[model samples]
Target: MSDALTLKAMLRPKFRGALLGVAVGDALGFPFEGSSHSFMAALGPDALHAFEAHRSGYFPPGQFSDDTQLTLATVESFLQEKRFSGKSLAESFLPLWRENRIIGRSPGCSEAIERLIDRTADWRTSGCEEGRAGNGAAKRMVPLGLWNYDEPERLVEEATLAAEITHRDRRAVAGAVAVAASVAYSLTRRDLILGEWIDAVAGATAPISPALARHFRDLPRFLSMGEKEAVAAISKLGYDDPATAPTTLVTPFVVPSVMTAFFWFLRHPDDWRETVGGCLRSGGDVDTIASIGGGISGAFNGIEAIPEALRETVVDRDRLIDLADRLHTLKEAVRSRRGA
Candidate 1:
């Protein structure tokens, strides 16, 4: 441990930033969840501010979707149990599912949660089947990074278990590991080295899905290009839903969505708005993509990097900050015990 002062000074703000980052991005991007590039472009140059002005009719302004809801469930489970518990995580997700509280939930996650609610399958087996690889798992797995930042093996185990609550595909599990491990890696680093971050994340992901790992490895190719060119290249890097025409929107597919998030975060590691705005401009699955990218950027840049206006707009902003503080406290205690 780097001493209590460093934990309070450096890590605490990162913890707050990561959670709130996911939420603010979720809320800001929620209104444009399935929009095409044209629709987003029509919002004009001040699209970020315009997002709130033209809120989705289904949800109130600044309300986050299932992404932040399930993420909180993970954080709450860790605080209450003081460890990662698949059973507790599953139990936490059930009430949200039953209450119709999870907004804009994907069909695969919905099916898996229904199985859990009906007792047709237990937590271990309730997740969507192997081929159903969406980003549902990765969105909520950031807490695992916060909890197990220094424990790689344990992070992998817990991330896999957490992903299995709603997704079982190796690609989906890989995506979860990548997102959580990216957060963990970002928390430990003092500077951003693009290649080093990609290598570490891809190495962690390789054991589960070599293809997904390869996609991450290929990210450096977009480094020199401008955002539009890079995002366009990133979109073509993977397959999306067959139903839709080819477009710049980041799909719900795990590989492309995860890569897009990675691209935007790496492109602007310290700028939360630019990073998340990059995801927003990509259009489809904006909430998930932006949430993932936002979490990583927040971990790197800390809480102050998020704009005051955007931070204030998030629902339950104070509660999210409190949870981050508690999680940081718990992490320090766990570290102290291990160091003893």
Candidate 2:
């Protein structure tokens, strides 16, 4: 059944769900990040769903990595100024970088933060804007759609600016637009068909770069395939760079990480548990793929749909909820000003 629940007036729960979902997904894959498929398989499904017991030395089991940290930072930027500001978003990152909180730094993002601190380069110029595209731009963009759900053009403009703080590649900007747009639509559109949803995302994204155009072009074939088939197909597409020896799935490369995440979410949209756990099961960059897929699934299904078992394990559940509520109240104030 299509969700009859009106979403325009009930953005709080969905917004909370989206951010909380990101954290949940990030935590899920954090332990298995960079592990080989054989390693993950040996860990088994029991380990995949195990909470508060991460093998990875970096975090305390349920704790999320830089993905959720930056996502929360993005939410904070809006709350701090009572509105969205790219400079604020870029500024928010510096503290994390300086505090040694970020798990691994994207060169562009790190450079942007450094430049922001020294007042040497503007956020626009400080970005490591080589032709290379990476996951840094896309991993933390969930809050952009939550804040500006009503405005796609504005979302595109704002998201691009925010992304340029670290990743200037047109492909990175395009990928961010696609993720933000998908989240934007979920906030309002209840009867979302899988194909049309991706088409809308691809349409908005493809115009920005040829690389993403090709990536999006190949996405639809997975629509009708089984989960295993879709995974295999994505692997064959070879979105990751081959030159990098011991190429881990948790690559900073934008294209494969995105396609892999989207394949899992699209495969099982209705079940939030499987959607997150399934992506982690695929291994390699487990946290980021799960974060992207989990956020989207959470936005579509609402936090209520999340299994209590999994929800119980998420780190800082109340804090995530509070951040979402703050964004909701701020969004309402903005609406009141316009008096729609």
Candidate 3:
């Protein structure tokens, strides 16, 4: 196959893999969101089992949460506009918020999007100072990276715009930049060493947040800290009380959660089951962690790398696949127009 064909072939599977991987990871971790690791350990070998062991009524077994829902919306926006635009993002995001039933239940997220829709506040200055930096921004950034896979700088720029729609805080933007950069780097280069990939992400995200910039700068040292210790270290970097200080507390959680997930996938590159499972087992912000991990792994391994059972169970799998294809087409359109 020609290089172009090879690159295009890689796009479909990575796109499908990234979205489906997120759904699978989200569903796997949904049942244990607030539960402690010890409680999960009490469940025996299959500690990270599906919803059968943990009940979430109305939500189907493999259904995703706000993470995948927002991601889908972002992908849809890219398809509609062929490039990232804050106004277009807000237009696309509000409907998904209502359509996915994310409002009321997820107050922080709902409030953010609602404000954008109502024009009560500009996305650039709307985030709550007390709002904890949950993984909300990072969870939805895969599409930005996937949409501009060939242009790492554009991926970072677009991902930052997508993130600002809901999370305008510096920390929130930093987390999105890191994840998006990772995805873009993974997509463009096949032979990247894991540490080198992490470094590249850190470098790309340097302008977003000093804390995040520092975190990425020293990531090589942290990589040896092991998953549990690393998570604990990350959790400590900020208060986890989302209700008390939403932005201040949450930013800490998202940075480490995204980093931990990326590292987990790096450690287990070939095993999708273990990679996704390790993300679930990492605890605290389970869905977000898994979403990040799944996206990275899926980007590196492709759709076929994901398990058959998990892939089949993703809510709206066909629709997500179609969306990915549409995003790819839009990307090509943008490239063609720019060349013209």
> Which candidate's TM-score is highest?
1
TM-score of each: 0.94, 0.90, 0.86
Candidate 1, residue 113: how far the Cα is off, in Å: 0.4
Model 3, span 1-340: residue lDDT tens: 9887787677777777777777777777666675554454455447444443236476666767777877787877777776777777777777765566661135556778778777788766555443456667788888878777777777778787777766766777788888888777766655658668767888778877777777766666666777566555554553456345332111225666776677677667766677777766656667777778888788777888877766776678789778867776677777788882
* Better model by TM-score: candidate 1 vs candidate 2: 1
* Candidate 1 local lDDT, 240-260, one digit each (tens): 543453565777888778988
**Residue 153 in model 1: shift from native, Å?**
1.5
Ranking by lDDT: 1, 2, 3
Over 4 Å off in model 1, which ranges? 1-8, 50-58, 240-245
Q: Write the per-residue lDDT of candidate 2 for residues 207-255, one digit (tens) a residue.
A: 6876775776677687677765565455444345545423333455677
All candidates in order of TM-score, best leading: 1, 2, 3
Task: Judge candidate 2 at residue 259 and give its lDDT.
Answer: 76
| lDDT of model 1 at position 103 | 87
In model 2, where is the ten-residue run with the lowest total lDDT?
241-250
